[model samples]
Target: MELVEKIKKSSVTAFISRIPKLHLAAVAGLGAILLSTQLLSNNKTPERQRTTISLPVTVSSPSIAPTIAESAPQTNSAAQWRTEKLKIRNGDTLSSLFKRAGLNDRKMMNFLAATDDKASFNKLLPGKTLEFSLNKEGDIEQLSYVLSKLERYTFSKDNERYSLEKELREPDIRIAARTGIINSSLYLAGTDAGMDDKLIMELAEIYGWDIDFALDIRKGDSFRILYEEHFLDGEKLRNGPILSAEFINQGQVFSAVRYVHTDGRSQYYTPEGKSMQKAFLRAPVDFRRISSNFNPRRLHPVTKTVKPHRGIDYAAKTGTPVWSSGDGKVIKSGYSKYNGNYVVIQHGGGVQTKYLHLHKRKVKTGQRVRQKQVIGTVGATGRVTGPHLHYEFLLNGAHRNPRTIVQKLPKAESISTKIIDDFHRQTQPLVVQLEAETATLLALNSKGSQNKAL
Candidate 1:
């Protein structure tokens, strides 16, 4: 029995000595995990704890926002400018305009006193604009008076003083053409062809020396004109001067080309370079019709007796402006019992022109007048029936017909030979444009006629 006990003890001791090192290490690791859990529950962690577990880390840049305190002040150059615009209305005065702009009379006077041309404000037309750029203190940094789309006056605030600058914008000028056929009157024909009143009047004035618009218009008379159309922002602003024109009166073609000379004077000339402007205009006033022609054996309407009517009577409206026929000196301007208000002008080269029965004489007896200058207005102050102008043209003290005398008068100098090539170079393109337009018109008219026949 003692021998068996000793063998059992020895077997137990051998088993303890044969335990593996891997199992011992696993036991030690389990004990370490249990100790770490107890430390985490107590909220006591090491300052530098190393870990073998892999974790995801996202790399990104840090973001910071700016505050309002860092923004620039209103008075600073980087600050935004406030703008205001005001349009001028009819019957608007400087004070009224200023009041509308939230300004006082003193402020307006201060602005006016700063400007050199105060008279420009006097002609403040309606539909103009005034623009203002303001600073932080509500002070005007810049002020602009827009006179037109092409013109403006800018007053910039420089310290305490304001500097004025006139700004002008050049308009885009384009060539335009129109064709008109006269059936009754030139005015009606021109208007039907989309011509404005001013353009029609200018066309008449261009051909006034050769054609009698009031008396010489026929049923088949036609005209073609090339002129300027001023444009801004792709829209038509206004009609400009006539570039080239052609008028066929009584089967006679008369052409006039605009030529700008070296002296900066623009004049119309024939294709052969003859001046279209004669020394005398065809008629003194824009007359509606001839009330009475010159007749030596006609009976006077007032006298009830036979008398010689040396002057032609032009029937026109009262207050119609009468123009000087030529550049001359006024010899007599007075109101008489027979002539009423009359003006007698002595032109050069033994020529004299007389205007009778005027409403008001614009020129004095000694005032030198230019051609086309407004000398008087038509009136009924004379011993006559109604408002009519008794115009007399005297060649060396003999009464001649004003309408026929223009043909015999001296003409203005034509484009000189030195500038004739320059004239042709500038005006030929305009002439070709007119010709092309006319050809197209003719072709269209022919096609329309054929269509009508079909």
Candidate 2:
């Protein structure tokens, strides 16, 4: 109580009482206005705060406002680009893909104009992907088209103009080995051993010159291969070329190793550096069965009279394709009462091949065709009882059995002497691997047989 009475009676209170009440009220009002102004400035809109400048401008005669360029806020040049990805679908075009990605036609046209070569883009296949990078204003800054696992196209903006660039990625290659025994067919055994159709076909082709897979394959035939498998980012992309292979057909063992010469040509060769390819294929078509063999005194199916069946008859589906036995020029591609839709090819060394009773002919007279090229499809035409191919081989105007004659013909050329040492060095390891794998398979088969006998 004593402290309060002393403060009330102090000289500071007497001094304040002598001042005017209007002056005190004016001071208090001024303080309130200053606080309100600070709160309003702190809560200003983003647009107003971004455009606010410290500089003050005066308009002459109060008739002109600031120009848009001078008053607008500058955009951030270092903004991160936004990305969107889209996949190609059937019946999808470049314009449609761009529109689906929220891009305009003008931008797409600009990109196309910048691309010098647009062949890959023109043939846009399904399952490919296109990616776009956009700026803050939704304008394309960068674009990428992934055509396949190996090839890609990129379009980037440089100095306000777009430029296209191509990129290619090489897959990592690793050696792979597989072994299989044939119980019914090579195709079936290959599938059981986890081989794709493409790889199986390639395997057949590698040994086709010596073993006519269409006819020479037996129940106990087996094969071992040491090949390449391509991978990218730890995932297998596809299978590469065969490095080395060993095939046993009808109790005869054949081996081949792939080698690439210094001149960039690649082919399969034997351990002693001999080529694995022959001048001609033994069988021209994949036949199911042999309807008739080469018989001089055979009863014709249609006439029931003794006639010389010069060519071998192959039973197959009507549309089964017939391939040229070797590289040759078509001598005749015509239809006759005896030979329906036949094609005759004249090869080197006085050798000629005749394909009779075809449903459709693919080659014309005088057209040069390579070995294994489809010339026609099998059909039952003139002088035939059913859908079968009558294939004939001629040597110097005399008919010969295709199956037996092809085996006796001259072998393919051997590797050149200059690259023999290089070939041996590169292929020796692959041959060793193939042999090891084959030995392991043989051991397993022997063990299984022994267990069954016991």
Candidate 3:
């Protein structure tokens, strides 16, 4: 038996020695797997004590797998409505603008249909801007159109329905003062002192009853005015009416203040509550000059003989407008051999005005004419030396000098006693402001003159 055992052992040893190194490794791996299975199957072994097994490693580049963060859905927080501003160009309509903005025609039609009577969007002007707010679905949320600095229109969507709103902005009004000295012409001096044409015209009209702007404005004449200026959002928009004005013409001072009564009637009055306007304007026409004054024994320009001149002559360009000196009714508007085209208006208190040598008569017989209304235009159609207006003023069917007769006519009505106090209260501050501004300007001018002389 001992011999047999020795032989068997020797045979096994030989078999084991003949196995290759790779086969030995394979067998060891199988044994390790079996040992791990046995350990995991044991109920006594704790789950925490278990270790993961590793397989044979291949030394190739690893491919990256997409993680949960990369594969998840993305969100855009900035995806919302946006606004676009479009200016109206010539020939651009609301429909065309909407089309260019990628908005549908149906919405525009709906918007127009809703705001048809409430607004006038069809009349779009150049340089006007239209702002539109659109949603993510390209639908208009709000639309705004600015008509002017004071007017605006807006259409907004509320609960799928559009409504139109018209907004009117009232400008803030403030008082402004200006002073001017006439050097050559009122227009030039007024404009040089920061006064516009409209203001200058207004100033002339306020004093039109006494002064003829065409012939009466003289050098060294100065004026002070207090008026209103309108502002919007801290920017100047335009000028308003004059509150008070003081004019010094030919060394004569005239002060006037505008007053509005409780009955809505407004007029200008002096500090003593006397009316600044007269019953008649001194001149019937804004003539360049008096070609012939009221001279009874003057030599006739056409007849070349000593004759009694019945009226004054105003030299002006042909077609120069002739105004009625006062309110009256025309008694005759006819043509004559000696008067060419003429108009005769009879005023209150047996007063009559005759306008002769007219290019054309604008009023007919029996027509009621207001003061300063154009009745005819100057012409040289009659027996005259040049294009001039022959104006005659008659009192009680007798001829009188038109320029001198107007000064003797009835004065304008004064402010009533009931409203005189109110007038003074409102106009006193304006007058004071005007006087202060004028004094300051005069001081500055004097200082400037002295500096120049030095």
Candidate 4:
């Protein structure tokens, strides 16, 4: 029995010596568990003594949490290069521009020869910008040529050669609204409402088929437009397409919403899915006012005699563009004493339109023209008149009023049944928003009036 006890003690000592330093506590606990089990199995130990010899044995593996110093820190690529931006001024050549960036002509020529897309860099326009990223040795390591707000060309240097990469970014489009009430003219009111000329013209063209801006616009007419504002790098780049609009003309409300088809074709339509475009425009030119209307018996300004006026006269500045009302072919484009430079177009379904007293005819005989295409410019070359366009619309053989005849003409095709549901899904929200905004504007105006009266 003595020999066995000595052998057991030596075996435990050898086991303790073999363990790692970090795991000494765990090994000691495991050895205590083995000794307790041996004491419990021996018949010589008393029950009370065995119960009193209590030792809690917990064995656990050692774990060390990683510290910050264990791994390498990450570095930003931009930190390695310094950037220099330059804008090309007028009369600045590529060599001069490169010199401005601290680069010599030899380096410029080397870069140009190494780049495969040298054609785009050949013609550098004024006001375009370029960025050069240099290394610590002041050598051009990267180059970025900004073509526009959304497009740029990047070149990266490797050894003595450079590789080209094109990058394109899409502008962030955000929806916005504008409202205006006409006091005298649409143009003035639109400008007063913080809109540019291009946006005003677009608004007019949207309702051009129904309202003649030169003749039918009234004092109380109001308009609310929902449109897109393109933003890049947290700044507005430009205004995008008009999403929807509402026009209240003399108490008659007209609504138009834009929808983009799956094929990327965009057009305006009413809430009922009918197109807002008609077969003919209500006015062929964007004139300030109408000088004369169609009259069967009227005293001529030049002749001072009773003569039948067969067309509406739009008074505008000379060189004001005149557009074709619909798709047709020019049947006559000539100069005469009464109608200086004029163009007559013959459309399908026995419809024809005539433009008299043009500064210059853009279309020739037998030439095709499309709707809204500029065919001529308003002029005073006729027998007697100022700068005005005499626009005539004829159906079959009888002349018709340009303002009232448009309502009688058929509108462009409506949304097809196959995509009517999709159209509604896209346009319903815009229609609702348009209505809500117009309502808010009306409420504000009413409150302002009440305050004034009080």
Q: Pick by TM-score: which candidate is best? A: 1
- State each model's CA lDDT, in order: 0.86, 0.85, 0.85, 0.88
**Worst lDDT window (10 residues) for model 1?**
48-57
Please, what are the lDDT tens digits per residue for candidate 1 over residues 1-454? 8999999999988986787666666667877876886777677556646546333354799897767776644556525657778898999887887777677888777777776667667777789998877776666677888988889998887766788889898899987788989998999999998999999999999988888787778999999998999999898889999999999999999998898887888888887789999899888889778788878787998998998888788889999999998999999999999999999999999999999999889999899999999999999997988988898999999988777887988899877888888988988887888899778877887899899999
- Of candidate 3, the 10-residue stretch with the lowest lDDT total is 113-122
Per-residue lDDT value at 158 in model 2: 82
lDDT: the better of candidates 3 and 4:
4
lDDT of 3 by residue, 303-394 (tens): 89999889888899999999999999999999999999999999999999999999999999999999999999999877877899998989
> What TM-score fits each model?
0.75, 0.72, 0.64, 0.71
Question: What is the TM-score of candidate 2?
Answer: 0.72
lDDT of candidate 4 at residue 74, scale 0 to 100: 44
Which portions of model 1 miss their true places by more than 4 Å? 1-102, 112-141, 158-166, 445-454
lDDT per residue as tens, model 2, 238-328: 9998889889888888999999877788888889998888889877886667787778787999999998888888889999999998999
lDDT of 1: 0.86
